[model samples]
Target: MTSPLTRNEQNSKSRAQTFGIRPDLFQAAQDHMVKKSDLDELSENLANAGVRGFTAATLPQNIHLGSPDSGTADYAILPFTDRYGPAVAAHPEPPSLQIEESGLWTVTLNLGTAGHGLAPAGSGFFEVSIYVGPEQPAGGPVRQYDFFNWRVELDHQQSFATTFTVDFVVESPGDFIYVQVSGMRGRAIEGDYTRTRLSVRKTDNRTR
Candidate 1:
């Protein structure tokens, strides 16, 4: 079956006639917006059209960043899976993307409160970077994964959570892609994380 994005692109004019310009343009009028599931499906369709497919790994836990010495925050790799848990029965290793064919992949990182804990002191500016290399960096020169510039800064009092997503293109197989997160605050407002995940969805060259 043709993908919705493909269908939408092909039938833009028809959609415009009914949507008043484009489906996206009507979002505000209709009080709606593009959902993650919609993008996920589109990304999946793009991946299946050329590459093997897409995959996502997540760690359901509360972690901290920019704590103790907030001035010089340390970056932490977002966990993909629980090393010790029932999930290990299904996911033996950390959730990872093993690119079979180099192509663009969408990566999303979401962070939220798990329980009552510290929120940022005032406002928080967090920078999350995606990286790929022979080995995980250890305070050394490392290859920065050049994807969309995905960064999020928010006033802690304004919101309790944030999500950063971007499309990244890879050209080879066996390359490891991961996320590192750091915050501007000296110490992260400590709290339980309600949502924390690193998702990757591959797309076809048509996305170019």
Candidate 2:
């Protein structure tokens, strides 16, 4: 007959066998034990390495379109009025973002089309474009970096929404980024300001 374990022995045994069946659980527990200060330091280090800047802007009001110009198929720039973060500054009408740092950035554009008479008469394509170039010669021509075409079929009372994301290398500190939209087949594209957004984030430390 063996004697039973004492209270101290039983407690020690329980502690030792706490993670007996799952070693992964034990490892997870160890990982969760990291101090908050350690995490703060890690975040600070990442920021210092140029991997933590993000900037976003939103349209201030819904875009209103006039009669569609059937003679042209050019893209019109969207205006961004509100800004968030310190990495970029939002320009006035014909909105553009002024880059304050030179690095590899991931740019994302979100658009929400309102149900109106500006859409195509039938199923057609809507085009969105992103341009990046110098800010000095305001209104000057810019290089198109990325573009997306979305097929939308809607009546005067239907809405459409889409998102576009692209990675771009910005080598000029004072460069400006612009977003444009156009409608095909002699139509126009308009968006709800509340749902339209443009965001930019640094993905790497390469500043050239």
Native-vs-model 1 lDDT? 0.53
Q: Supply candidate 1's per-residue lDDT for 165.
A: 77
lDDT of each residue in 1-208, candidate 1, tens digit only? 9556676565575675655566655645556667888999999987657633455555655556545434454566665663322221112135443444466666666655321234445666666566664344455325654533445665654444667777666665455656666655432422233355555566554433
Against the hidden reference, what TM-scores do the models get?
0.53, 0.60
Q: Write the per-residue lDDT of candidate 2 for residues 121-193, one digit (tens) a residue.
A: 5554555667776642244345544444444444544567777788877776666777767654333334344
Index of the highest-lDDT prediction: 2
lDDT per prediction? 0.53, 0.62
The Cα RMSD in angstroms, rounded to one decimal, for candidate 2 relative to the true structure is 9.7
Where does model 2 exceed 4 Å of error?
Answer: 1-51, 66-74, 85-94, 118-120, 136-158, 184-194
